[model samples]
Target: MLLCLDIGNTNIKAGIFEGEELIAHWRFSTQRHRLADEYAALFLNLFALNGIRLRDIRGCAVACVVPPLRVVFEEMIQRYLGVNPLIVGPGIKTGIRLAVENPREVGADRVANAVATFRRYGGPAIAIAFGTATVFDVISREGEYLGGAIAPGIIVAAEALVTAAAQLYQVELIRPPRAIGRNTIQAMQSGLILGFASMVEGMIQRLQAELEEPARVIATGGLADTIAQEVRSIQVVDPHLTLHGLRFLYELNRRR
Candidate 1:
């Protein structure tokens, strides 16, 4: 069995895989100040609930965007799980070429997404992760990471708006009944949800235009389902894309 983790700015998604089958998975809020023992306790409790023991974990892989949490999880895994987890970063064997300007600057989560997308669906492909920052990662037809765009996530935009504006408060990020909002809440919803959907559509068109060919679009992250619900361009809403990517990379790069 392998333990795979995709640590993002907003959440830490962990999965326990028995062979290729993901047996158990869970998500926890990202707490930077949390101790290794504290994280271990929370996960071990989750493992117990799922009937997975610590020793059941043979190997581990991680794709962490938060640098501090990388070291923290490394320590936690070493102390509790007793495996030297493969932390995805530069020099990892992803089996996918990165054609970007600075591959080092690419997020591990993005690399994992690229590897998983190519392995599972092949390219050309676009993976949108709607987390702290809504990220778009493009994979070429040749299975290369071709880089994409980043935009403020809807929650971030909403929070910023609420902070800046005196009267507007946060509203549920659901699609408005109509584009022409009748009320303040409806207006905010229209701008946040429907507006993001339009951005997604336009971005897909622009990216597809640059590719000069149609590419499959997949989405992940906490808010992926919300945005994908309104966007017609998204073909798949795979919440665990990054986890599967970690699992695949573990098999590829683990010591023989």
Candidate 2:
């Protein structure tokens, strides 16, 4: 089985694939301070619960944004699975060409998303990841990784709003009945959820206009379902896009 991990700022998305088929997947909150042993224990428990044997894992692939956790997973995988994980980075054999000014500045998760987006949905395409930061990754018709925009994510914006305002407090991130809410919670919900939805719509138009060609837009990440429903421009939302991409990349660079 192949273990593919998409480690983000807020959460770590993991998938266990038997060949090309994903058999099991799980999400764990990102803990940067966790040791290699701790991570291994967590995975062991998950594997046991899923009826997977520790020795059954043949290979592992990772797309990690947290720099500190890189070595942590690397150590865990090497010791537990006895496999050198194919970490998504500069030397990886992803087919997409990065056309940005500073390609190194791009995150591994974004790269995986682009690879999966173009491979699964072809290009010109746009992938919007609604995570800690709302990221927009654009791909050209020829499958080049053209850069996109970034904005404050829904949760980040909402938290900031609440923190900055003394009277405001945290509310459930759900859609309000009306755009103009009658109550405090509803109003906050409308402003955070609907407001981000509107922002997504506007950004799609702006990106499409700049691209000069009609691009297929897709959404992913935790908050994708929450906000995607409100945006007409987004028609596809594959939460496992990054995981799929990591698997694809691992297949490409697997030792012969």
What TM-score do all the candidates reach, one by one?
A: 0.98, 0.98
lDDT of 2 by residue, 1-256 (tens): 9999998888999999998888999987999999999999999999999999978998999999999999999999999999999999997788889999998888999999999999999999999999999999999999999999999988889889999999999999998999999999999999999989998999999999999999999999998998889998998999899999999999989844
- RMSD per prediction, one decimal? 1.0, 1.0
In each prediction, how many residue pairs overlap at the backbone (N, C-alpha, C within less than 3 A)? 0, 0
lDDT per prediction?
Answer: 0.91, 0.93
**Can you write out model 1's per-residue Cα lDDT over 1-256, one digit (the tens) per residue?**
8999999888889998999998899998899999899998999889889888888889999999999998999999999988999999998888999998899999999999999999988999999988889889999999999999999988889999999999999898887899989999999999999998899899999999999999999999888888888888999999899999999999999754
lDDT, model 1: 0.91
The numbered model that scores best in lDDT is 2
The residue pairs that clash in candidate 1, if any, are none
